[model samples]
Target: MTHLHRAFLFLGTFSSLVLSAAVSHGQSCANSDQVPLTKVKLEEIASAVGIGTNDVELRFEDFALETVRPGLPIPHNNRFFFSADRRAKAGIANVVPDGVIPLITITAIPLKTFIHSNSVFYESKAVRRTRLPPSYQKYQILGFLDALEHSPAGSEGSFVPAIVFMTTSDVKAISKKTRLLATVQGVGILHTIACEIPDVLPTENNLQMGAAIVVNPEVYILNISFPFPSPPGSPGRVRP
Candidate 1:
């Protein structure tokens, strides 16, 4: 067989294996209803993957899968801030105190994944010189990758944090930006919540009220209601 043909076979096998590992069926995801953003609700689903299902869910890798799950509506999963580091510990701040920022649909991968896959190009001095966070900072997707900026309460134009969803494309289109677009098909959320960070690092356990970057913007989305979302000023606990 040709070298190119052999490479394609390897890629296909690798993709299948990785996807299977990412997707785990949970007990309650059977319904299409927007999963509530509440801690109890999310933990129940996170439990399906054996993440230890604490009162607070801190598994950012597994958390990313939830954001992309077929059964979850874009708005549903966009509820809380997730971090691969978990040290920032922004896991339980559901729906931001400012309340649902926005939702944007774009095809995208984790920034860490995108970087590592292209590490061949950036592996040398380039990786060292680049300002990008390390691969362990998986919650990031590069600053302003979403091409979106949201208005705040009255007059501020703070780029509100958003919940973003990745959709499949049957055909690919090429873009010519060639400099900083995350991907032609990729989309990412920009807020302290997802990376393109909001500088919530100094906050009390990285809770919603502490997210000063987009602090208390007028409600943007999640117009549909859910039961017992975290209220402002009360971040609850980061972990149980």
Candidate 2:
């Protein structure tokens, strides 16, 4: 089958899977209010990734979860709110708490430095893209957030916050090769860039961001760096 044909088939199958699960296991917003956001566990995230509870773990700086209320569409204003790192850890705490269980959306930063340091592991591209079952698309906003609290000081790079809209088209584009594509200032004047993931090499020392790799619709690879130098008189150009 051609790529487009395969993509359509994949979408149909994926939709069925998502719909089936939603009908059987889906919880309502009222249910969300019963379980505190702070009480979310690894199992919840695992479910989000379409993995069994045994397949996932709660690690520092791993996946981020955002709670979206029912009847509300994600990206309501071209932006979404995520729990602070502290709140996230609290929800995953062992102690159960009585409170609203906010509908959870997951996110992560695929930082080159972190990947190079071996602090984070990348999931397979196929698994990342198809695992979630796209029915969650409306309720979930999958993308990366620019580091606002921890960004470098006085860096030339703009630090606007932004999110990526993942689609089949995006996944196919990144799956071919690795290279930086484009950079621009997004929300909050933050700098963002997209790159294609390179084929893995045995001798390679570091895994970089910016290079795209398909890792679920909601997961994003982030490139945090200073803007490139512009020509002598172009706009936003700076002289050394």
Candidate 3:
């Protein structure tokens, strides 16, 4: 057989192998379902926050997820804030009260599995230095919360603290630009609740709100009647 023919045969075999591997991976991912949160888990998470099982619900307005990329470092997650009515009713609403929000978050990453499977080129400095995408970081917080919230009631578990976790690079980047209270709308009754770090150090690594509500002490049962903040120069109440 000619050298060129032998080379072609080897190349064809390599291509076929690559294609097969790709197809297998695609199938595996397609079959994998994103785990769902269960009711039991939610109760556990609530209990951790010093609330009874009945006091907690998975339903929170503006539950969202955000992504983080390298160099641009900010930590965010799928967060749930009480509505004004619920906040009042729950008696956990606070406006800049000293303490942390009694909330928890969890996170998971599929890329870690990918890195584990493909050992080759995994140990490179670049790969080692690379951080989990911002979305994954946020998701980790959600996952942890979800797991705790979904765990079966009566299961032996402790409440997880609210702390933002990220790679050192990301943390440094966030420290420079991040604010203690991130004023956001869509919290319904809890709209005024600020997203701030807890006074305690070495807290859970992620965005967390204090469990206690103090802003409008007179108001109990945060109803969904509050208005959202207005745009710049618009005739509306500015979010503090």
Q: After superposition, how far is residue 33 of candidate 1 from its true place, in Å?
A: 19
The sequence of per-residue lDDT tens digits that candidate 2 reaches over residues 1-240 is: 999999788666655553343233222112222221111232343354465544443210122111111222122122222424323433321211111111111223443321111111112211133322211222121111122212232122323222222111123333111112112212111111112123422122111112122222111112222211111110110011
Write one digit per residue (lDDT tens) for candidate 3, span 196-238. Answer: 1223221222122111111221111112111111111101110
Candidate 3's displacement at residue 226, Å, is 60
Error of 3 at 53 (Å): 15
Could you give me the TM-score of model 2 versus the true structure? 0.19
Q: How much is the lDDT of residue 213 in candidate 2?
A: 23
Off by over 4 Å in 3: 27-240
Go through the candidates in order and give each one's C-alpha lDDT: 0.24, 0.23, 0.22
Error of 3 at 165 (Å): 18
- In terms of TM-score, the best-performing candidate is 1
lDDT-better candidate, 1 vs 3: 1
Model 1 lDDT at residue 129? 24
